[model samples]
Structure formats: C-alpha cells, structure tokens
Target: MTLGEGTHTIIAVAMGVDGQEFPSAPVTFSVRLALPAPQITQPEAGSVQDMNLWIGGTGADYSAQVQLLEDFNHDDYGYSLVTLTGGWGRLFNLAPGVHSIVARQTINGRQGPVGIAHFFKVRPSRLTTVNVEILPSQEVKFSGTGHNGATVVLTYVSGPNNKPLPEVVVANGVWQISAPDWENGIYTYSAIQKVSDNAGGWIPSQDFQFSFPVSTKVPDPTNVRASADYSPIFSGNGVTGATVLIRKQDGTEAAPPAVVVNSFWSSQSRQEWGPTFDQIVQVKQRLDGQESEPGVGVVVRIAPLPPVISSLSDNELSPLIAGTCWSGAVVNLVFSDNPAVHTAAISGTEWQFRRRTEFAPGVPHTVSVTQTAAQQTSAPATRTFEIRRTLLKPVIIDPANGGEAERDLRVRGDRSVAGARMQLRVDGIDTGPATLTNGGLWYIELKGLAFGRRILDAQQTLDGRPSERSDPVVVNVVLMPPQFTTPQPGGDLPRTSTISGTGMPGARVDVWLEGRDDFLLRGYPVDSNGRWSSLVILPVGVKTLQARQAIEQVVSRDSPPLTFNVVPAAPYIETPVKDGHIGGSAVVSGFGVPGDTVSIYLGDTLLGGAPVLEDRTWSVPVTLTQPDGAHVLVAVASLDGFKSDRSAQQPVVLGRYEPSIDSPRAGSWVSHPVTFSGQGRLGTGQLVSWFNPELPWAPNLAVSAQGWHGLSVRALPAGGNWCRFQQTIVDGADASTISDWSESARFEVLDPASR
Candidate 1:
C-alpha cells in the first residue's frame, strides 16, 4: 500500500450471514513514507585507520534518523539525524576493531530496512620503544615513544590479574608514567597506546607485554670503628660484594676501597698515622654502580704514653711505687729480681702500685713500668731503690725462764716489727712462722709439746733478713691440768669432799679455792693410768674450785674453774609409810630444809614436787601408773640451785580392785546353776550378777586377804546366759569405792532332750 508522510485514521466492521453489518470501535494509526537505507561513503570497505573515524551515508529521507551498527553482534555504535539540505547522515567514534556497519533510517516513525554491511578496521596504536627505570628515590617510572597525541595505558600484570595504571598522554612522540609507591620486586606490565578518534573519543590498541626488575638500594656502612695505632684499620658491615670507601672529614680519601665479603668489610690506611693525634672519618658503600649515603663519623683516639715513676728514697722497705700515665690506661710493673708482674688501672692521669713483698736489704733493685690504652702499649720507664736492714730480735714475753707450758701452749713475744715475720726456736729446732699483731707483738700456738725442760727463743725477720736469736729462756713443758671426775660443774658438794681427776703419772696435783692464794690440797698423789686424787675440806658456802698439775719445779696452768654449791643433809620422805599399799592418786610427804623444794621420784621417773613451808614439811600428789606391783620411791631437796642426794628408799605397792571370774570360762556348757570364782584386791567386797536377756539381783561376795571364791549363778534358760562381777573397798568411816564392771562370761545350760 502507498502512504503519505502524515497521520491518518480508519475503522472496520464485522458482517453476519443474513446481510446485517455491525460497526466496531474506531482504531487510530499514522501513515508515513518509507525511508531508504543509508549508504556509508567516508570509510570505504576494508579500509584501515590507526584511530576511530567519522562515518557518513546518503539516500536517507531528510526527516529520518540514521542508526549505526557495528561488529558481528550488530551493536548500535551511535545514531545521527539526516540533514535537510542533502538527505545525508553521520555516526562517530567507531571503536578500534575489524567491524561491519549497517545503517537504517526512520522517517516520520516509519523504519527502513538495514543497508548492506560495510567492513573496515580502526587499527591499534603503535609504540616503537619502551623502557623502565628505578629512580634514586626508589620511584618506578615507565617511559616509551608512540604515535603522536596517543595516550599510553599501562596495566600491571601480577600473577593472573591485571591492574590499570594511570594513563599518560604522548607529546612529541613520547610518553611516561611514574609509580612512586611501588615496592621492590620484579614486575610485569602490559601497555597499549590509545589514539583519539575524529569525534574526540579514545580507541585502544593491542596489548604489548614487558617486564622490569626493581632492585633495592645499597645500604650504608654500619658499626664503623677505627683502632688507635700507628697504622689504623677501619672495619664495618655492608652488603655482600659491595665496595666500602673511607674518607677523612675533609672529603679526602683515608683508605683504599675494600670489597665486602660475607657482609663484613675492612680497610687499612696506606699511609702511617702516628699515635700523637686523633682523626675522624666517614664511610660509604657502593653496589652494582649505585652508592649509598655516607654514615655517621667515627673517631680514632691516640695511643697512651709511657708511665712515669715518682722519686724513690734509698733504704726504704715495702716502698710505694706510684706514677702518672694517660687517662684510662693500665700501668704494668715488672721487677728486675722478681719473676712476678703487677698492674694497676689508671685513675684519671695517675696510677699507683704498692710493693707487697719486701725488697732485698742493702741491695739495689730495679722495676720497669709501661702503660697500655686502646690496645696500644708504650715503652717502659724504670726506677731503682734499696731496702734497709733494720730487723730487731724478739723477746719472749710469756713462759718466763724455767716456766712450764702444757700441750697446745700459746707463746707470745715482743720487740718485733708490726709486719715482720717471727718464728720460735724450741730446744734449737725452728718452728713455723708466727702471727704478728698491729701492736708489734707476735704469738704462736704450739701443740703436742713434749714433757721436758725446753729452752725457748724467738727471731724477727724484715726485708728478707733475719735477726739473731734473743737471749735464751728456759721453760719446762709439763702435763696439762687435772680434769675432775667427781663433783661435776653445777653439782652439789659436801664438806670434806674428795677431788679426784686424771693427769700424767708422776705429776702432783694441787687444788685451790677461788679467791684464795693458798692451795687447799697440795702435793696430791697421781697413780698410774694418769689418775690423781685430793681430799680437802670445803667451807659451807658456794665454791669455785680449780686444780693444776706439776712435775718437779714446773707447774701447769690452773684447770677451768668448777662451780658448785656445798649443801647440808638430804631430805626425808615419811608418808606412804614403808611397804604400804597405794592406789590411784596418793600423797607423798617429806621433811626438808626450810626454804627448799622437795621432788619425789618413783624409780627414775619424777612424780611431782612441792615447796617446803616454814615447818620444814612438804607434801605432793602423785598418780601411780605401776600395775598391781611393788615400787620404790625417794625424795630429793633442792635449795639455792643446789640439789641434795636422794634420801633413803621407801617401798610401796600399787593396785586396782576390779574383779574377774576365773571358773567357767567363756563359751562353756553347764547345768542349770553356774558356779564362779575370781580374784580381786584383798579386803574388798565383790558383787556378782547374771543376765539371761534380763538382769537379776545377786549377793555381795567378800574379798578376803586371799582373794574371793565360791560365787554361784542360777538360771533356768536352756540357751545362752552371761554373768559379770564388780568390787568395792570400805575402810573405816571412809566412803565406799566402786570399781568398773568386768567383761561378761557367757555359758549355756544343757537341754536334756538335745543331750
């Protein structure tokens, strides 16, 4: 059907079989002229361009719009309205790809058919060269030359992923992009140049792959140190295979370059620099044609100077050897005649060393000293001096001529130098060295001295020279003091006590009382086996006694003072009369000296004690633990820390009145009435009772002097029955005492049928 280019309306009706017609609702529509397909004239078929280009076509209605399609998928790239003057239309920015384009036009809402497809391509941009550089500041920069006015798009390809990088526009055929924060590693990148189309849109090129290695910078030298010597050595740590350079603070080379091996580097200065002055230097490292910044300056110190010796006086013994040296230096001193060396650390600029061993008397001795600092030693300085010969003989102050000393004797003397060595001569034999006190007195302990008359002397040595022996002093090495076997310390003693002890035979012992010059017993005899005895009368008071032993005219030192109390008569225990019976708690009474305490004893065990009153009478309560047997007891009196000997023995007996059945032992079979017998305390009354599951009254059984007997029990039960007994003691007008019930004795009555 032919239609004009304008809106029009029409309607239709339905006709039935009987020739009757019904009109339908009116429908609206528009009629417009059909437009012809557009033709592309700008880009010929199969033609190629480096960037997107504008495409135009003719033969479309002037009022129609042209739509551009691209690629095999027929995607609409763009659309444009036809111009009224020439009936032509254009589309812009066709992307870079081998493409086929078909154009269609719509005139007054009526669409035309698609035109024939046109084949063309927008070629990818081109790049001639690409390079990657790592700046000194560790920034990564990518640069290349490509088509003019083209944008260089870079994508960092890491593993299987791609990251878009910032684009750079090419100017004068060159382009560059910087990644200032990129880490140090090998990196791969794919780049493409994007050129602008005629409509000012970008067209991407094919990917170009490239790789670059971003290396870490070389590290500066660390721990730079220099030794203080005539030829100093510099050392530090750096990267392996790198070169370390050292320069003075003034920028002049201080040492030749040294290559680092195993992260360590060392360089020695070629020229000799004396130890008189200090120097400062800097260090740097270079690796792979790259240099690192210099490190902090290091100072090299000067060597120490030789130690100086102070003036020395002649004839001085144990001289003070002092000198001056550099600060922080160690001063070493070596003696010419001695093989030992001594050293002293410097304090500030001064050093001192004292001579401990005395120098040879009356002979010149030389000593040399040197100072060392910072591993450098100086030359030696020397001094010479002599010690004086001034040793005096020592005189024996103790153990006078003809005096005696026992074993382990202490010998003392005087007239010796404070620090001089002293020795004793015993009967012409030299003993070991003695200890000298600060007051110029010397003493030595001599053990195991023989018992004989011995001559004693002493000698003094100073500055390695010994003086002649002092005037001879005769001494008698006698027996030690007698030890007392009786009357131990802090024990009681009576008048007319005999003091006996052991001592060397043939030696006589003399006993003396404290605060008295005269001996109480003199010339007491000592028997064989080193035994001695002395019978002396002591006063009635506290006494301290001492004894000494003597052979011929020499006497030993007095024995350790023995202290004891001289007590009077012993105490007497009167109560619990001799051989009397005791049970449970009992009273023990005794007679003692007034103001004394009496302690009672059973055998060796202490029962209890009581203080004596003004009447000289004492009583104490004692519990008896002895089982029904006879025991002995005694009483001792103590007064003023002195105890008297135990008094005469008093015998007693302990007993319990509990009764027991002896006849018809437990678990026995018997007839109707049971007979029982038992033992208990004499003179006590016992009661027997029986129970066959029921308690029954029984009669009291008398306990005579020989114990009780003949107690009978009667029961009719043909089964088990038991009986028990208890005791009581009744003494004139005293309350009765009852004992606990004894264990039950069970027995069975015989049944006639069963028997």
Candidate 2:
C-alpha cells in the first residue's frame, strides 16, 4: 500500500521481547491532491490538415493555476494560446510544421516539471499538388503547382517520419526538386504551400508514392569457342563496369573476372593443362557490386591431342602416312592441292592411310591430319615429306633399336603394296608371319622369348613373289622388375636395417630414396642366386624407398614404394631399481645414446632431465617429494627431435624409517576394515611386522609401491590399543638391509556395534 500524494503524519510502534510496547512521536502534516500537467490532444503528429487546428488533452490544475504553452510560449500572439477549461485545455490556430506542447502547474508558488504532449502540425488553407517521376538512372524528380509566388515545401515521407527536401524552387505557381541518386525502394512524397504571406502557415497535399528499382537484366555469354591448343575464349554484353564470372560445371573458376566496357566484355583465353571431357560452362554478371542471376549455360567439348608420329616413309607410287591416336577416333589426311579427303582405319589406337597419287622426286608436299572422337575434332597435326625410292630396309615402329623391350614383342613395319605377306625372324630363327592389315601395314607378335638381345628382320612376298630380306633391328629384352618382400608398406623399421628383395640372378639393384633424386644411378650389386640385400642408414623419421634392377646398360621400372618409420632406441631407468629403497635425494641413472637428453618421472611428477655423456650413460639426482613411502618412476630419452617411449616403471621406497599412523592418530578411534597406513623405509614386495596384542601379522600383506595396506577386522572391544611397525629388505635367502622398529603409534579400537 502506497501513501497518497500529499503531506501527512507518520508514526511507528515496536513491541519488546518481554511483551513491552514502545511508540514513536506523532508527526502532523497536511494532505493535498497533486494536480497533473497539461497536455495537447487535438491534432496528431505528421497529419495534413487545414489552417484551423485545435491542440488539447487531459491534465491541468484549477485550484493552483495551471497553464499550457506551445513552442515554449503562452503569452505572445505569435504562439498558440492555451485556454484552460475544467481539467483540459486547447491551443487554437497552432503553427504549421512540427510543434511540441508542454504544461506546468504552480504548487505553493513553486513551478513543477512540465509535462509534454506528442508533436503536432498545422497546414494552410490551400494544398499543393505533387508529382513524382523516376528517371532511367533511378534518379527521382519531384514537381508541384501551387499558389503564385507561394513558398512550396516538398518532403520525402518514409513510414511515419517526414524529411524536408532541400534546394526546392517555386516560381509562377510551379515548383520542382530533383535527386541525382536514390536508394531502391518504395517512397512517398508530399508538398506544402505557405500562402506566400504567412511565414508559419503551410498547407500539405495528399501523399504521392513512387518506386525505384535496380536493373535485373543479366547478359549471356556468346561465341564461346575452344581452340586447338585447349585455350577457351568467350565474350558477352552487359551494363558497363559489370563483372562477368565464368565457371566450369565443377564449380571451379574457369577464367579471371572481366569488367564490361561500353556494354561489351571479352574474357582472356584460358588453357586446360590436360585432356578434359565435355563439361557445361556457366556465366553470371554483377552490377554495382551486386551479382545478378546466372545466365544460361553453354556446353563445350575439349579435344585431346593424338599420338605423335615418330617417323614417315616416302614412296613414289604410293606414300603411306601412319601414326597412333585415341581408339575409335576417325583419322583424316588432307593434302594442299588435292580436294579428295583420305581416311584411315583405326585399329587399337593405330591409324594408317595411303596417298594413292604419285609424287615427284625432290618435291616437298605439305600434309595435315586430324582425329575426331566423340564428335569433337582435334587440332591439325601437320608434316612435310618428299618422295624418293632408294631403300627397302624394314623399320621398327616401336621400342626403337638399341632400346629396352619386354619379352612379348610386337614387330611392326611398312610395306609398299597391298596383298603383301611378310615373315619375321628373331635372331636368325623364324618367328611367324607378318599379317597385312587393311591399312597396308604389316605386323607380327611374338611371345615367350628369352631375356637378351633380339635381332629382328622382315621379308615381304607380293603376289607369291618373295622379296629380299630387310635390314635387322636389334633390341634388348629386359627382365621382370623386382618386388619388395620385406618391410611392407607402412611397416616400422629399425634405424639401421637391411633392405632385401628378389630380382634377376646377378642383376645389380639400385635403391632410390624418396626426395633424394640425385641417387638415381647408385647401384648395389646383388648375389648370383637372384636375391639381393643392402644395408641402409635411415634417419629418425618417416622414410620411403624404391628399388629397380639394372643389368648391363638397361634398367627396369622401379618397384612400389615402401613407406616405414625409423624410431629411436628406447631407454630404461637403471638406478633406484624396481623394489629398491631410496632416501632423501637419490641419483636416477639410465642408458641412452650419447648426447641424448633423458627426462625422469616419479609417479607422474617430472624430475627434470640430464644429457647423456659420451659413454652412453645419464644420471639425474631428484629429491623425493613423498615421505618414507614406496614410489614408481620412469625415464624417457630424446635425441634431436626424435623421442623414445617411456621406460618401464621402477618401484622403490622413497624415504627412511620414520613411521607414524597417517590416520586416526594417538587418542583417536577407528572402525573395522582398519586400513593402518604408515610410512617406513620398506621396499616394495616387503612385509611389515606389526607388534600389537589386538592384531596379528599376515605373511601375504606385503607393502606396495604406495606404502599403504589394509586389513579387515570383526567386532572389537572399545579401548585404547598400541601398535608398532618394523621393515627389512631381504634378497633371496639373505637379509640385505633392516630398519629399527618405528616409534610406537597408538590408537583406540572402536566397537563394531557402535560404529
């Protein structure tokens, strides 16, 4: 409950704890109603109306004189006069534009804080008609016609707010305003005329609305073409300064951005690094830093180059051009003078065609050919040759003479006439017939040949007539490559381990380490039993190696890579050995490589590190943080950036014999399952002898690395009991060290029924 707004008397009373009552002095005061300030209510904010206006609202005091003011004045004739009536008042004929009404009341001859009403406006008698127009550039132009010589005001209306437009001019009943740039959105405009005589009078017209929008036209890329060299070029038309984005179907950018200049844009040529299948290309335009919708896409196919033509033979009667291309591609031969187009039969990526017409000797003819695959044509491959018949030597098409070839050989040669059957001989031994194909080319395939030098020759018989034997083509047959049988891929290997593999007998094997390309020619000779082994010094890191066989001057392909890791040798803590005793600060010794930094740990507590000496030994002295108890420790060694695994933990006693009951000290009592924990100079796996009449020592209750051990007990009499502990370290059949009996530590045993 709140007290009324007035001066009043307040009193208070209190009651004592013993029923005594106390009362405060009586405060006298007077009560009076607090009259509210005046407010204007008639004309709403931003409303367009005639010159006659009324501003009024509830709130004013009659008993203590209250008054209202518009624009901070109620006495001057230039301002609105607020006449008070009953608890409400009205200010008549208020000025135009924005105005605020405020009310103040005098109480006890003191003026109170004024209360203000919502802003209001008053318009003149005649309104001005407003017209709005939007230009091509999205510029807004506003015009109006009002009273002659009247100062017409134009305003931009957005939502419930009105802002006056600057630089508006009105002459001879005409007024206009223009904005060079405007944002895109729906807008409302209004015009007001001041009557040209009254400075404060303004007549507002009805709202005129208009909308300015951004351009939505997106240009499509045109004339997209791919050249022989795989360079793709395209052009398009769009708004000036608009950016064109070209991308492939895979969402990867195909070319750099191109800015439109004078409504035209041409993209720079983009080349594909290798063969590409048919893919759809898309393009979009961006204007004023805003991207438009993507345009229609264009599908384009990029052709790959055909196999190279290694050599060509010249013939007077019929010139034959043969080479290799992609399988299923149509091969076309084009001559400079002849309109007749020649085609070749594609057989397993090989194409051959005959010129048919005779060519003059010493005359060079420009010839070009193309290959078409999947309806896509390749760039023209051109060559120039002269016709001169003088030799009948057979030429090897593949695996040129003196080069290495596999055991299975395909002997190919060119014949001058059709219906010619050829015979092939390898090292003077008849191999097989060289069947003539429809393309006037002869070839023979031989398999199961021994690995060595192969001398090949071909003899052709035309119309049952045998021709002289051709020249011999010598080729070296290489053996099968070696395979890695040890240290499989991703396997772990020692730092200095042997790499062995199987290869041809007596064949020298060359080891190539990854990232060490300069060791290509280094060879390790293998034994004559077709087995090889080599000692390699690998660094402590991930290593990869491959091997190849090199017999005489020929080298086979490299074997698959073998990836492995070279790890550092692990170190172990030697001193303060497992189950041993240590007191105060003890030296921790470990074995590691020279210069290795060994980190020591005592049950997860780091004890710093020490560098190993040249004798492959390291020692670090550490203070035991635990008091007279067993503990476990480990050691790790790090050399360079390679670190070894943590060594096996060593459990040892950490302090001397200074034992005391850790819990339930002297004069305190404990319950059953009495875990009597106390520290002593006892080694792990050692027993503590308890001298107490209430309890007996058990042989199996040996002290662990943590020093504490538990024993379960049944109900015991509630009374004081004394206990003592003694520890000794004993080797097999011999006592090495013994600690004196610890000082007597006493505690009371509680009854199980009362616990």
Angstrom error of the Cα, residue 424, model 2: value is: 24
- List candidate 1 stretches off by more than 4 Å: 1-392, 400-410, 414-456, 460-466, 471-491, 494-505, 510-524, 527-563, 567-584, 587-598, 601-635, 638-642, 645-755
lDDT (Cα, tens digit) per residue for candidate 2, span 112-186? 566764565554434524566654233456776764554666556563334356744458767877765454455
lDDT of each structure? 0.72, 0.63
Candidate 1 lDDT, tens digit per residue, 289-357? 888874657887756657788755433467777778877777898887787879875689888777767
Best by lDDT: 1
Best by TM-score: 1
Lowest lDDT block of 10, candidate 1: 730-739
Clashing residue pairs found in predicted model 1: none
| Every candidate's CA RMSD | 57.5, 41.3
TM-scores for candidates 1 onward, in order: 0.26, 0.25
